[model samples]
Target: MGGIDREKVKGSFHRQAKTYDQYARVQKRVVANLLDQVRKEVGTPGRILDVGCGTGKLLAELHRLHPEAQLFGADLALGMCITAGAHLAAGAFVTADAESLPFIDGAFNLVTSTSTYQWLPALDHAFAEARRVLAPGGIFLFALFGERTLFELKDAHYQALKREGEVEDITHRFFPPSRVEAALAGAGFDQWRVESTLEVELHADVPALLKSLKKIGAGNASPRASAGLYGRKRMLAMMDIYQEKYGTTDGIPATYEVIYGAGRCP
Candidate 1:
């Protein structure tokens, strides 16, 4: 994968800041599952920092879970940070990139992110930063989209582009679980665990899936994505390909491959 344009990523989430929660059902589920894991492994962290804390939903829940702990949130998008501030009464929200968090070393006892690492260009740098910011034995936990995510859409795009004689990449190359675990280990984390699961989400149609993705600020931010708006011909071709191959009696299926990672900075 090529380097991601940070400004474009910030812009995408900034535009969706207000409506993200409405369309982020899978994300909410991921957060709930992550919190459950946290409860099992770590009862309460003395200090917490949520990287890429979009709208601070997890932070809010963490506060309720550990009312006495200090909570903080950081995101690359300022609009998201502002929304997080409005949602949380006492926690501090900062606009910062995950790859280079602007915090002192050993500042947090727990660092977490959910459904956000896929946009990052360098997982190693992000993990290094997370490890740098965590206290000794602190937990670093996160969930990211794995390589199988959106395979339905990806296959459709591939076939559609091939038919047009354009063999170009149109999606981000999501990391596999092995790569994620290697980065965590290289970043000085110990006692690590990485798990992946494939989940299928049903959408009414191709258009509905696209709309849901846009509403949640998860539209294709890949630099390899087609340069211009997909014309009606391409759109129809992609939709037809998707429906013919992956559509079900219930609806069109969009597959989500989620990777959950947990480690302690040693």
Candidate 2:
């Protein structure tokens, strides 16, 4: 897997910190579904740690559910951590990387993340770190984008560029459910379950879809992604291509293939 540019990712998310919550509908939904699953499978955790807890939405939710439990959040972006801390005046927030958590072994009973792992180049390191921090028999629950995520947008970009004998790769190749399961197992997790889901959001046009991504600071952080901002010509062409191919009676649909995984450290 190609390594992600950490500074680039931090900058993007930091820039969107103030406005992220407005356009993070899909992310919020992922957190909600993940929490619901946690509730169904096990009770509220005694101590909770949310990796890549952007904007602290999930932390706020967890706080609401288990007011007495200890809660914490960490993210690579300082601005995101600051914003999260300010929003949720209770939880302890820190700037940390998932591959190398700034905590002692078995520091948390439950570790979770949503829409964050795809940005990581090595799932093994991250999973291992999660396992290290989790107590014995503790649950690790997470949701990540799978390979099929943003296919429509990706396809549109390729097709638009191909018209001029060029190729545009603007997104990361997200890990599949099978790969994620293998990574979790390799990290010493047991009885893990991985499931795939398609979450679709409708936009009136391609620009709106792009705006949604920008608002959530989700512009690709892949090393392969273009460093420069998109040009007007290419942007317009992609919009046309997407509308021509995947447009429905309602609107253009941006599909997110969400991979949900949960298991226990043994």
On lDDT, the candidate that comes out on top is: 1
lDDT of 2 by residue, 1-266 (tens): 44677788889998899999999988889999998977777575788999999889998988898888899999998889999999999899999999989999998888989989998887999999999999988989999999899899989888878876876454567888889989988998877989999999999888888889988888877776674335777778888999999999999999999999988977
Q: lDDT for model 1, on a 0 to 1 scale? A: 0.88
Q: Residue 253 of candidate 1: its Cα lDDT?
A: 93
Worst 10 residues of 2 by lDDT: 223-232
Q: Please write out the lDDT profile of model 1 over residues 119-202, one tens digit for every residue.
A: 888699999999999999899989998889999898998888888999876566788999998998888887888999987889
Error of 2 at 45 (Å): 2.5
User: Which stretches in model 1 have alpha-carbon errors above 4 Å?
Assistant: 227-229
